[model samples]
Target: MTDYGHDLLFGTFTTPSAQGAQHVLDLAVTADRAGLDLVTFQDHPYQPAFLDTWTLLAYVAARTERIRVSGNVLSLPLRPPAVLARAAASLDVLSGGRFELGLGAGAFWDGVAAMGGRRLTPGQGVEALREAITIIRDVWDTEAVGGVRQDGRYYQVVGARRGPRPAHDIDIWVGSYRPRMLALTGAMADGWLPTIEYLPRGVASLPGLNARIDEAAEAAGRSPRDVRRLMNFMNVSFSPDDDGLLAGPPARWVEQLADLALTHGVTAFFIGGDDAGAIERYAAEVAPAVREIVSRERGHYGSMP
Candidate 1:
């Protein structure tokens, strides 16, 4: 078992549809009112059908009272790291520390190039993301003696001033899947956020992938537990029959998620959908049950002297 002992978190992953602007906002408000921990939106800057994620996040932050907001995984190619760090901090401050950064090394190369962003190879993208993370942290280090300075191959910040400290220490969650990216997450990121559908071998792939991350973290002189495991389920159904991983009833979901927490150390779960009713059911039933079960199991293990 790989329980990291972090508190469980449940969230909604909704599409930021430009056409259904009001509906998008309503879903965020619903997640908030239903007591979900986080409300995230997919970020596809080149997609004209979607609202600008950063703008939507700021708006959602202002609209909701308590729920945290973030891009499901913001495309890093279009967003400059220095500016992104400052923007993240400013939003966190404005939102009363209710902002988490979910970043991605760019995917969809054609769209990225269409928008004047660099079209990098897979290896190059990982290197760029590494540099970007360093620059972002330096920018957030407001108490540091001097301005941020990183003459990286992909990015260069020649003594840029860092200020407007975030209201809280913001966690940078990286959406990663490949070996190098997973290693990067283990070495640098605060959390690992990967969508279930993207995994090559589904749930079975986690242990091997997680081993790579753990090895990288150990090599980086950080504990494996330092990286919080977060997973996103894109196809979830609150139905009666046991269809698949997350396609069964809430009780089955509770069982499956509890197992994930105990066996894989996934402390956070994000359900992807736009259904308000499903979100409500998940928040009311699945989340609490999973938390209860995980807590009990952890207590049992903790007491084993």
Candidate 2:
């Protein structure tokens, strides 16, 4: 087992379909009440059929009491880093620190260009993401002697005032897979966010990718533990018997996910589903069972694990 020894977290990913706004909100509330650790939504600024993610997040923060809210991966190319940092901090403060920043180097080039966002090449996207992280973190540094100053090829912030500090330390989780992005996550981000279905080789690819992150972390003088690992199960199918990855009943999910926690050290697993009852099933049934099993087998999690 890899056993990075991080605490386990459970969450739900809801699509921001404009027609299903109330249903989405209700599902988020259900997840929060069911003791899920987080409630995340995708952010696609150029999508006309979707509700604005930031607006929905603010409403969710006001409605839910404890569930940490975030973009499954907010498109950084469309959001100015300084303003995004301030918005995140404001929400974090307002929600009593129940917030995390899940970011992505831009995707959907056509949609992005339609919205007046630059359609960056893959390399430029990665570099821009790095620069954005720098700008955002600097903007959040209330203790810095001087203000934020990041003059990068893609983004440049000159002496921007840092204020409206977050209620607690906010985490920047990057959704990345390539080598450069993985290294960036290790050196700078607090967590690595990747969807299981999109992985080139599923969990089979984790060891190599994680090794890259670890090496980069060590190179940057940061412990590998500094980068938490979070994965989301996209398009799950629940049934009464074992089928496949997140495709079976609660027990099957618990067993498979617990294995992931023990073997790969992926502490957080977010389910991409919109059905409220199924969300409850995942939150109340699958999540707790996985936690209990991992805690028992891992030891350091104690009884609560």
Q: Pick the candidate with the highest lDDT.
A: 1
Quantify how close model 2 is to the true structure by its C-alpha RMSD in Å.
2.2
Model 2 Cα lDDT, one tens digit per residue, 163-214: 7789989999999999989999999999999999889999898988889998
Cα displacement (Å) at residue 94, model 2: 0.8
Which residue pairs collide in model 1, if any?
Answer: none
TM-score of each prediction: 0.98, 0.96
Model 1 clash count equals: 0
Each model's lDDT = 0.92, 0.89
